[model samples]
Target: MIRTLQSGQQCQVRIASVTGESTLLYSTHRILLEAPNWTLDGRSLILNGDGKLWRLDITSGTLIEIPLGGIPDLNNDHVLAPDGESIFLSANDGHIYRAPLTGGHAQRITPDDGSFHFLHGVSPDGAELAYVGIGGGDFRQPGRLMTIASDGGAPARVNVGEGHCDGPEYSPDGKWLYLNTESFSTEPGHAQLARIRVDGTGFEQLLESKTVDWFPHLSPDGQYASYIRFPSGTQGHPADLPVAVVLVSTGDWKTPLHTWPLFGGQGTLNVNSWSPDSEHFAYVAYPPATQTED
Candidate 1:
């Protein structure tokens, strides 16, 4: 349920529920991990830890290191292809990459000159990837919602004029991509839940509020969306804050059915973590900020 972090505190990773209860899946020894994806088979989970990818066998309690040949540092920005044969990830250099799900050398997808690249979603057909990139602009470097071919090519900006767009996950049919875009507040980036088409058309706001919202993940059955919410006026999704994972019906996108508390903020739910059946989701919560010396 909980493991000691480098900070000498218990770090928790939970398989969260929409309504009733949530249970702990796995934990590590002073090694905090980010992002949790139940494999297509539903027997194991894939997560990034200690700057490399790890496959945690749920039934056997074994951990196998997934070999990413070239990238020495992996971030929270990673996703499994829909077919579960490929992986798309962002390395420390802020460039996108693609590697086989079985694990091997990674081939670069984005230019090496960029400052930040976060791989949020892979389309159903595995032909396109929606991600966030900071660059392509002058000083101050704003983030953009962009999609690129899985074979590696230039990224096309998805929203025409939307500002600070992040977390782009595709609809089950691949027609719409859900994401979050920020508005101006007393702080710099205050996010909202939204969606757009793959062709960069049909840009519409799904949920608008004064509170900061991010990571809009659509269910596989096309009925609901799960996302995380931070307190109003929070500049960004920072760590160790009082946060909640709120579920909303896709049609209304306003009223929430459940609100679950957490001790994490940034790496809690950065990627699409819904189960194959689309009934449950996954999220990570940290130890308190006060603990540090494991």
Candidate 2:
């Protein structure tokens, strides 16, 4: 329940109920803990830390590092397969790779050559994977929302817009794709959560905010959406500000049930994965300023 990071710190992260009772879920000594994805059975958590994917057993409190092998430069948005057999991750090398959960070789899934591919999530059926691909040489330029069959094939663009589209994920039923679009023209960059039918129809905007709200991940039951809400005034540098884990009712996008502030110091919180039961999620909290010995 408590994991001591290698830095000699005791369990720095603790989970408590709304009443403040310790849930004893995780306590890690690791300085950088990000992208915690629970296995399908909920027995283990897969997290990316120290530039590698680690499998932590909940019961035994043992940590095993999954060898990515040849694949390097993995991002935070890796996803586990529906059956929990394999995982799909994004490599900074401009490609997507699928590797076994137990550790083995990794196979490339995208041939994007350029640094246009940004990984998102895999569908519940494991048939398709969604990602963001920018056409212009500069990543700041608006990108495209794309989806491809997991087996490897030509990817298809889902949205046509000038604003950069990113953080694509599928509804629990795989009926719709949820993503965020950031338009430069809008003040503070409007963050729009849109739903696109899998068949590529009925592209509708579900929610838009003047403040940046991205990383839409549907809860396991598919009833609520847990996403990151960047505080206002931190537009272009969202990665450098604190964030809140907000929950929105899927049935009604206008209603927000809960919001929890995270990484309060002058740092940033990058939320990556959600638990299978949707009870708890994992994220990385970075400290902004460090003391230097004078």
Candidate 3:
């Protein structure tokens, strides 16, 4: 979907410590930034705004746009490849594309199938991509968890039951794909955290709660995880709502290591934002700009 920064909304990019501290890295009312991926070198972050990609240097606090010769506007779903030099992007055109991290022409990966590919994860070895496929580009159809060869070929479906699913990411170890699914509940829009083996076995829910949870991003070390939590009964991670970025130990997701409350959702923590060192992760907030007195 095309996302525009609504009037009076300011985008704030903040880095949070796993231990419970958050630092504002950058804030701007000019553009709407979403879904940050920390660079391998830990020097900068890659985010998409204004239908284009941008690089934010954490230390220097500088923002630069990364131009793509091909491919349409991008969605929040983008994953950095394991090689650290390549990236996989989900464009508004309903196909996936691969491009250089530094910016260049994009190579389309998914075929011109009837389905729309929304990318979320690349394998640890960068051999495959896990994404959600909406058949016939139909939003009414449940998103099916799918995987395809990184270079592009016939996509394979990983049955996630009858319910809709999103954010199928590979574990750091590459053994499992983590995501959120609504199969566990019959209620509409009630997505919960879960994971299944890459081979489509061992499906299990990570935790249960009345609150709707979407993306489950694991740290590089595989010891911790971070996910977005919405209010109970909220339908499909929407914008401009009260949400929380919850951090927890992978060993026990039932307990939260830290919870950072904010007035943001959707683009806030959509992708895996954990820093390479696992000490920090990035997220965005879009709290409306308070009016100034005349």
Give lDDT tens digits, candidate 1, residues 134-212: 8843325557888889887777777635467788888999998888886333346788887778887887778778789
Q: What residue pairs are clashing in model 1?
A: 7-292
State candidate 1's TM-score.
Answer: 0.89
> How big is the positional error of residue 242 in model 1, measured in Å on the Cα after superposition?
1.1
**Per-prediction backbone clash count:** 1, 4, 0
Tens digits of per-residue lDDT for model 3, 1-294: 667777887889999998899889998889889999999999999999888999999998899999897989999999999999989999999999999998899999999889999999999999999999999998999999999999989999999899999999999999999999999999999999999999999999999999999999999999999999999999888998889999999999999999988888979999999999999999998887673211
| Candidate topping lDDT | 3
lDDT of candidate 2 over 1-294, digit per residue (tens):
111133333222323222223334455545455556778887887776666788877777687788878788565557888888999887666778899998888999887545467677788889999888866437666768899899888888885466777778888888988887764335545666677787878877877565677767777788777667776555432443456656677887776776666543111222235567666554444433341111
Rank by lDDT (best first): 3, 1, 2
What C-alpha lDDT values do all the predictions have?
Answer: 0.76, 0.66, 0.93
TM-scores, each model vs. reference: 0.89, 0.82, 0.98
Please rank every candidate by TM-score, starting with the best.
3, 1, 2
